[model samples]
Target: MDDLALSVRTARPEDAADLARIYIESWQDTYAGVISHTLLGAMSPRTHTTRWQATIRTMEKHSGTVLVAEDARFGAVGLCSLGKARDGGCGYDGEVYTLYVDPAFLGRGAGRALLTGAFEAFKDRKLRSCLIWAHAQNNACFFYEAMGGRRVATRTTRLLGELTPEIGFGWKRLAARKPARPMQSRSDQS
Candidate 1:
């Protein structure tokens, strides 16, 4: 990850397809054994694209945010959607609705970059604390823990028809970050 260069940006409507692909691929990779193959196979890229496009628009219209992570050569590798807390009684000012990295790009720092971007957006919105709910069985929980989140709660929700359990990870405070300075290449310095 040290050598990988990644950038996070606000997602636009044009990124819907890329996000859709990432969503499907990541879901398949992450939930294969836990979720039924039939259910996973039912995921539709076209439908996801439409939903994501509308979602991006709505997020922009509202105060929420959608973020995309890109590599210099691999294009869009990950996405994160976040906004005000939706579920009541969470005691969190902000919530990360979804965070997924393309299967091929996992462990390459895309997730890290996107989470960092989400926190920055939180600060801009004056959201001082954050919460993320992930499937109880998903490995993403480990990643969230590595990112300084504390396990605060758990609950069950419906996914398709099955009752799915989730773990809530909370961050009591977010550190303010300064704007990054652009790097100058040696060739440009000459």
Candidate 2:
């Protein structure tokens, strides 16, 4: 998809609306059938605008980065957030706070590219490891595994008054690893 011409850069305050749209669309698409529709509905634009606005407006004090992926053809298609672990329990540990790509961009390498950008940001700060949490029932579990993340733990919690389970993945020197082989190629026999 080289012809797609995607670009990843830090998000600006002006991007709040686009980022919020992507978050809602991606979450709804990715969490369908996994998270209760009621819960998702409760967390949609009307309920999440304030939180998303604050996220886009407030800059983290630590070595953190938020990136948005755009394409001339697709506009703001994906976004990711990475930062130091909040509690300092894992010294110098970085975290992939959020990573989401437009459903239309799925299978086009947008998610992988966004994650690569996040890793590079962490590496620039000299972080040795990174952590990411994914919903256990979400298909992204396989994607995280393919990215070389090892499952470290799982936790269940009540969100929006419904039980949800999240799986944690860890990666060391994540930025240093080569990108995974693409699922399709020009010579694919299929």
Candidate 3:
């Protein structure tokens, strides 16, 4: 599958529905035990679609961006959002607001490719650093760590009658550095 073709591009308004589907699927699968069942159950496909459409519209209105990863077979398999960090009170210089890969594509390199694309976008904007947040129970924390992110802070809150803790990871020069070695490559995976 080394020759399997895939592309990464800036998300378009037309891609919102597909992006949302992947987002919801990934979230439900990855966050099932970590988030409240009530919250999870409440997030229907319509909710994700509406939210993604609105976000895409707003990003188009402004200068922010969303990105999508597409494979020849799976169409859009991953998505991510990037914008100025100040939009939220989290206070990072820049933020990766969303990053989700289809559950089927999880072990592949689609997530890394999507993130590398985001880093290029941030670099083009001259941003110096960026932040990503993941729930403590999500295994993505380790992936971020492997990608050179440093744990900067931890946040705790109650969701769905349970205590959920989130960890924040920061990449000081998300756009400027190169990986020391090539990440593993997979063909036709995403």
Candidate 4:
């Protein structure tokens, strides 16, 4: 964290609105030119708030997790949602469905903290390997690459009637990390 004083914690239901706002904001900042302007224009915090509320509750039943990264100076700067891998072909045990740092907090180590938190969440579920998908044209790929991710696969996903190219980054073996909360063992959680 390098003096960032960032902390990661499981998200609560009340956080949906804020998470939604950040999600939309981050998307607007990162995907403006990458995705269709019409699609982005249609995104609203109201719909996402409901979506995030359901996601937070549904993940509990599915062994998935939503973690928020908070800095001492800024409340909730970033978040990550991850769980068991969805595609069997990927051969990864865990996958990150969302990982974004608010644009205002982009360069201050929030993204790195979020990735580290994702690994920790995966460890909690006994997952040893992980993968994350990013838009092929998105600049976050370099951040993932710098964080030790390898470009292993590519695919196109249909989003808002457009075929959007994406790249999948993977980690075959994740190094162990210090527990987010010291009171208990992560292995005990699974």
Report the number of clashing residue pairs per model: 0, 0, 0, 0
Candidate 4 regions off by >4 Å? 1-4, 176-190
Shift in Å, residue 59, candidate 4: 0.6
| Candidate with best lDDT | 1
lDDT of 4 by residue, 52-119 (tens): 99999999677788988886666788888998889783899999999988888777666777788888
TM-score of each prediction: 0.90, 0.82, 0.83, 0.88
Stretches of candidate 3 off by over 4 Å are 1-4, 87-91, 157-163, 176-190
Evaluate all candidate structures by whole-model CA lDDT and list the values in order. 0.86, 0.75, 0.77, 0.83
lDDT of 4 at 54: 96
By TM-score, the candidates rank as 1, 4, 3, 2
> Which scores higher on TM-score, 1 or 3?
1
Identify the candidate with maximal TM-score. Answer: 1
Q: State the displacement of the C-alpha of residue 137, model 3, in Å, after optimal TM-score superposition.
A: 1.8
Would you list the clashing residue pairs of candidate 2?
none
- Decreasing lDDT order of the candidates: 1, 4, 3, 2
After superposition, candidate 2 runs with Cα above 4 Å error: 1-3, 42-50, 87-92, 176-190
RMSD in angstroms between candidate 4 and the native structure over all alpha carbons: 6.1
Candidate 4, residue 13: how far the Cα is off, in Å: 0.4
